[model samples]
Target: MQGGTTIVLPEHRGHRLGLALKVAHHQALLARFPDVEWIATATADVNAHMNAVNDRLGIRVVERCIELTRPVGRAS
Candidate 1:
């Protein structure tokens, strides 16, 4: 099982709803599947807030993907 997504309405954003959702999700997953060793999650580079929350939840970056974009006709 995985965290589908967490989207808090603008008015609800600052209340740590995303963090709460994720932590609760982790707890529920562990309860239902205690033998599971890892739960995978991801966030974009610009999303510092969610990253902070994930860090608080003991999630670490085991790997990262960097996306590079350039004009179709441009090259080094």
Candidate 2:
């Protein structure tokens, strides 16, 4: 499992390395573990660039998960 931060790097702008790496890693994992059924990843819904690459790679948005947090013991 891996998670990435923002995509505001000037050196990486206009390059698809992030997408390429993600795809390559996914393929490698699949090849290394043929028995595995699925490989998963996540990115912000607003990240259209990542979404486009994911679409190209045939990744579908299966479920939407949201994180809810509250102060420990501070009930609503």
Candidate 3:
């Protein structure tokens, strides 16, 4: 499972480039690796745009991960 990164230039957003790129990338990778059974990618939960695209592609939420952050000078 590898390679499904989609990035749209800021100036090129609003044209569905991200969705198109992801679908195309997935198709190409699958074609080149027919033996693969699972492919994985991660995105922040709040990113509705990408999440929606992922959902449309039959990807599902299998796990939830939380990242904790603190300022350098702040005590935990």
Candidate 4:
């Protein structure tokens, strides 16, 4: 299963809510799907807190993806 964006309000930071949320979701996923063996999630490289949460949950980085964008214009 792949996780989507998870956020805790700025006023609610530093309470380990992110970690708790991930843990709860993982437990629920396993409970609902005993045959499932893997879960995937991604966070921006700058997001240290989320990275820490994933690390604590034993989620290792297996791949890296980079996004690139360019403005479109009339062809010359």
Q: Pick the candidate with the highest lDDT.
A: 4
Model 3 Cα lDDT, one tens digit per residue, 1-76 = 5554577888998787888898888788889988878877899999988898889888998989999888676654
* Every candidate's lDDT: 0.84, 0.74, 0.83, 0.87
lDDT of 3 at 43: 91
Using lDDT, rank the candidates from best to worst. Answer: 4, 1, 3, 2
What is the clash count for each candidate, in the order shown? 0, 0, 0, 0
Q: Candidate 3 vs. truth: CA RMSD?
A: 2.8
Q: What number of backbone clashes does candidate 3 have, counting pairs of residues 3 or more apart or in separate chains?
A: 0
For each candidate in turn, give its C-alpha RMSD to the true structure in angstroms. 3.9, 3.7, 2.8, 2.8
Residues 8-59, candidate 1: write the lDDT tens digits: 7878897889889888888899899999998788889789888989889898
Off by over 4 Å in 2: 1-8, 70-76
Q: What TM-score fits each model?
A: 0.78, 0.66, 0.78, 0.84
Give the candidate order by descending TM-score: 4, 1, 3, 2
lDDT of 2 by residue, 1-76 (tens): 4545535366776688767777777777778778877657787799888888788888899999997887766575
Q: Model 3 clash pairs?
A: none
What TM-score does candidate 1 get on C-alpha atoms?
Answer: 0.78
Clashing pairs in 4: none
Candidate 2, clashing residue pairs? none
